[model samples]
Target: MASSKDAYRRKINQNSDLGVMRHQVVSLSFIATPFWRKNGIGQRSPATCRFPKVLGTTKGVKRGLVLPLVATSSQEARSGVNASELPNRGADRLREAVTAREAAFLAVEQSLMQNATTSDVEGTNASTDSKMSRDSPNASHLSQKFLLSYLALWSEARKPSRAEYALAKIISFNAVRQRMLFDYVLQTNVLREREAMDSVPRRIKSDNLRLSVSQRALLHTALAQYAFMERVPVHTIVFSTVELAKTYYGQRFASFVNAILRNLARYGEKWMPELERRRPAEYIVRPLPFPEDNLNVRYSYPGVFVAKVANQLMNQERVVAFLEAGNLTPQIFFRIPCQFTDTAELRAALEIGLLVPWDGSRLSESAARPWNIYRVDLNCADVDGAGDLVIAANTDRVEWAHALPDTSAKDLFQKLLQKFIVQNVTQAEHIYDLCEQLRARWNQRRRLERVLDLCTAPGGKLTAVFEYLQKSGLGDLLTEYVGVDLNGQRLQMVHENIHKAPGMSKGRVFVGIGRGESFVEYQSGFVVQNADDRSIVPSFDLVIADVPCTNSGVLNRRPEARWRLSERDFATAIPRLISLQTSLLTRALRLSRHAVFYMTCSILEAEGSGLVRSVLEQFPEFELSWERLTYTDTAGRDGGYAALLWRHQEN
Candidate 1:
């Protein structure tokens, strides 16, 4: 029912309304926008603006030009408006203004330097000065002085160690604060090889030509005199000498080194790659058959052996993609202590680029204020694209559970159990049930006689055991609490913490520093030894043998372990496990009434049941007490841990 002209008018009004609303919203952002976004923003003026107060107050101001009433009265009234409307141009200009003292000092220095130097400054000219200068006596002398002074400075900057230049080049490249060119040189390894060649001693061989020679030259002829005179590689020495000569002397000196090096490279068959080309038969046109199934270039291992384990443990595709992603490129993270005036101020000053939250679980800012500000850590990673995995990297361990490929599910789950333990007490009963077969013995044994803690050093488990004993009031009942370790330093920890918490029975806690075989003399007390070591000790009663095996349980704990582990390691560990069991059982039968061998490794028959089988075969006196332990009865377990109790009856 609407007329065409009326519809057009409505459309125009709608568009005008939209335009006014859009402009109003955008206008709100102009004056109050963030300072960082203020760059390139143009100045805006109100329509029909009044003249400024300076112009209005002028004595010759025209009546028509100025606002109504008295010009003075309007000027006074419009002062606030003028002040508010004025550009903040002078605000930024204040930051650039140089102090009077500084300008005066710089003026004096400029005049003195220009007059005092004959042609050029001491450290300003030479190869770095790409600008061409007029040739004159004074200019040439000044250039020579500058070169000498610059070279002296360069020489002084060299590190003290002989190979320090090479090492420093690498270290400085890796350092976050260093120049990008240093990183490029390090990546190329140009300086590394140069330093190596420059380290050798030299002797003058040709007195007439005055060619300096190294010991290697004694084995070659005089044709190699110029090249063999120095320990440096012929090509490197020639190229470097030529480059330096061109910088200082002229192109002719560089040409001299080049011609000599070409001859040396031709004759130096012992050092350089051969460049001879033999002609093939011109008429031959027979096709060579290529085997389709041949693995001529396939089936070889990827990267290093250790890297293989890491790849297997981590989600390789996701990790690779994540590393390539700019988002994950080692973000800069800092652990700032709470000492600065405000954490925000310090963070602002220190933050040069993007910052990310720390990944470690243990990264907690201390409640202690000022000290906390100073004690923060800083880290950096670059961000790539969205396809890469967002790694929860705390130190070296990067866990990307969701990022792993579908094919890697089995390995992924297996490693997950190894990395985390059930901290919840409600979950512990189910976890404990899956760990050991001898449920009856664990339930019946109201009192524990002797406890063995194998692999007890670096004791997360040790602390738990001590706490368990303390809570149960079983610490007093423990006659001999033995902690075994191979590391001398870790043994020191066992010695210290065991005495402090849940004090063991008087004179019963024994700390063994050496390998398990070192305790072969004793049939009882406590013994700590590596499983592969010689088994000389007597049998134990309650053996707490936390045997060493493929650490598949802790893939998350050791990211590198996944790539390092192989079928060969699994195969190799079986025999070692048997040997360890033989050693421990031999000692256990003589010492304890029963043994409890605990391990973080899976309860695969190879390590747990397989070794138990070998122990039963060798010692007929011992029996697998089904009533005391019940580990194997359950199916489809989470941790894949199993326990078996071996009792040596009185024969």
Candidate 2:
């Protein structure tokens, strides 16, 4: 029998990594032990062996002897044992703590399902007695998120795939101990911990109480991870947990937690497996259709549905191309010696762009012709504090006018500003950082030139371009650092922010509120046809067209948009958008020696790469060059954009 087990293991290893289901075989071996001895040896061992009766197999193998007799090579067996020890220990502990909680949670889910099924099965005549979904103690602890997490963990555990384990670590509980802790949290309201069950509020008393062995184990694992992962504060963890619990289970979270924790404290080590035995079938069989690419990019995302949405926008193949091509989230490049070399400085400047001094009220109130100013605050709740600062020019001017720090805090603020800017600033700051990188690249190419930003309103990228030019010694070539936009208000912002050369502030940057694709009349053939058109007069030596896109890449900034978006809307809009791009690019190509056309969108295949492809195909005279950007810690979340540069040489 031992030799036979060894032979089976050898066959498994020889088959190849793709074929060897190591964990499955190990589980099967355990299940086969009793059958192996019972039928193969034709004898029953002493009652000392603690084994389940269901170990019998479909093949003629009996339960008692099959598993024990199967032998593995010593090295293989040792490796397996070593690999299993940590998880086993963690699982065992988790089971001990969360078994009861598991049972309670399972009971709640079962009752809910049963009640739902009964309601469905019996229709209007279904008894109200079985109609209550949250009528168990564990119902308070169970939420859609919690249940999904549990289902994910259990589904992963019963299979050989490590995908579940990876997901389990992110969204579900990993071991039995974590569940035990979670159970305790659900069952207790610390202030009223001693209250009798009957005295509990009617809402609390009627919550679900179902759970099982595996779920309890899962709870423990989650708890263990929560306890570690040093980045988040414990209070934040507790707050998040409570919030999550309430989102799903409602009023019963406290009491459910209390009961689970008490059990964990008492019998965590002893009764884990017994509790696991009662795990629900739903927990084990839940299916996951999560995209593999998203799995790597967005580990913190909690729901599979959300992952599905992300997958539709950015497929794995594109994500891989983006990664392999080394285009990622761009870095925040800053010029030194500026007092406000961060988001705060950028924020105040509004239209000046880069890390410069700013006066928000001035930019907002300025009545100049071509004002380049805008803000984007990423935090959903804090609308005012979020947003990027945009201007159409370079860094030196921005720093001189806006971010010039006061004498008092100059040294201290400068020393510690980088840390705060990187760590605590708003979402717009991240965008500003990326723009800065582009600014640096622009400076690298054109050493000393009075650059023109033709379509530079709401000027984060514009300001970055300006600053990069300034730092690269191009300020001397400032005959005309012109900024043009149709918005008079934004141009006014540009006027108010520019302090270049004192009197030359008015002379160096000719702020014009005008259209790029126009001949003084500000009317292109397409615009004349549309009638609902507005334009400002503009043509320059350098044109930057960061055209409007679907804006799907920055969903975190505008979550309200995710639900509102659809393929139909995109289909209808893309043609119009492309027309606008063509209009801008045509004018840009003819007007400027070199032109850059860029947009921020994760659905790069269509809106970005496709757009570039279309332009190159249509305009044979214009040459296109491409560069990929960078994003950090976004393995799972999508934010890769495409920048296409078209240098127009005389045809």
Candidate 3:
């Protein structure tokens, strides 16, 4: 397994340096036609882009290069067109360029396939990155922006403009988010001609205009643009994608690229049913139940998830809202210490024009939200709260993350009043609520100070947990606070976050690396071991288990989680995930002296309510006192599940 740091570096190379081109892929660039014409390369063909007389047909290749003259919605009539004519070129040069580019394409095709398959499998926190996607966890915790940055670098375009980066980010996320639907569309219209789902994608003779996984990814990118970004011109989508194939793969692919994308436009776009930007994502995702093609693509989720929805929520409109919410861009929200009172100042610093209602207001939290958290809108969310941005007395700050970008006075809020963690309103609200509940008990039992924040990444919820506890007057009560995570580097962050807070005696507040199920309570502190301990270990007064899940509820924020997940595959994956969730909760109970906190960032019943019932059934001594499930809302908050479990029979 790649270390999280190594994985983090690999993702960096993919997006920034393309240093991993040898192992993954190398992209090449083709200047767009309009940009070329504007630069005095007017109308003459840029070295023979037409088909060879030897190929015997020009199915997709045209006399002109493929690019679009973009027009706004107001000028709807000029939305799209094919490439413009280019100058004829020497035959020898055409053939040579064709062979070299085609060969490059062939080399990277397999790597592209393998990389796409791994999109949802692993993650590591990419705190050092400065992109919008950095704050939101990348798939495997890096590279939600990986592929597009990857394409740009391999193509030797070097640094992309912020606009290019933003476009790539949106396309990359949409491709992953709606991969199933895109694949479904391609499979039905084009891929069925060759795709072999049971095994590796077999290559066809190059003469037949074969579709490689590289081409499939390109098509997916194009499709994502047409479906999600309303302003993108269809002809431009064609040109960009076809040029991608022509420049990187060779001219051999440009025609096929041209043909497939036009077909894509025909089916779900410009010429077909005419998908509208405001319409729900399900508009073009319809396939009949008889084909086993349920609305999984419409919802961009697994069939097992769709079935679980029917069993759990059981309401049509609510389900639609839930699905639609995950497809919209999630907002950037932060948690303020309950102690802060400078709302007017904070708002002035972070605001542009209108201040929307609190996220709590959506949850009917009109009172608690205004004081607990205030939403800050910035075009960039990856601002590291360094220097003047610090919001605390002794450098304690909340670090929150968001993947998408927003529009605002990017300069005015470049620095903020408080260094707070990037958090969802609903999530922060729930955590605050949980701490308040713990407050009553802590008031009675002053000795309940030992705390274990289990399975959290570095600085995750640990900082928030401390602040919430402080507000409840329980901050000074802690003698031992141990934050445990699977990643050592992230745990180091936990140490950095908690080590500075008021209660610091050596070894009293620290972090341990390894699974919570095997973490051992050591003398005055904690240590994480890979296996069972032979020696006795003490228990924590409260164990907060923010266990991992499928990230179903947060698909908008965690798009990578959706890939590698399918209706058929979820049957296997969900069970394994439930097993892990079960193990973490079961172990947390054993490790706790008083109560165990079980939480997941998932809306699936199998992982949320259902799995909890199953796990608790085995332990008759524990009872669920309270649990809250916040569904993903169109208002931009990520969904989460949090529950408090009490041990009735004392140890």
Q: Top TM-score: which candidate number?
A: 3
Q: List the candidate 2 regions with Cα displacement exceeding 4 Å.
A: 1-333, 336-455, 458-478, 485-507, 512-538, 550-583, 590-603, 625-651
lDDT of 2: 0.34
Model 1 regions more than 4 Å off: 1-439, 442-446, 469-478, 496-507, 521-540, 567-590, 600-604, 623-640, 648-651
User: Predictions ranked by lDDT, top down?
Assistant: 3, 2, 1
* Total residue pair clashes for candidate 1: 63
Residue 528 in model 1: lDDT = 36
Question: Candidate 1, after superposition: displacement of residue 28 in Å?
Answer: 63
Minimal lDDT window, size 10, model 2: 128-137
Ranking of predictions according to TM-score? 3, 2, 1
How close is every model to the real structure, measured as TM-score?
A: 0.32, 0.36, 0.67
Candidate 2 displacement at residue 11 in angstroms? 64
Per-residue lDDT of model 3, residues 321-364, tens digit only: 88778776677665554444455535654454322436454433
For candidate 1, the per-residue lDDT at 439 reads 27
What's the number of clashes in each of the models? 63, 113, 22
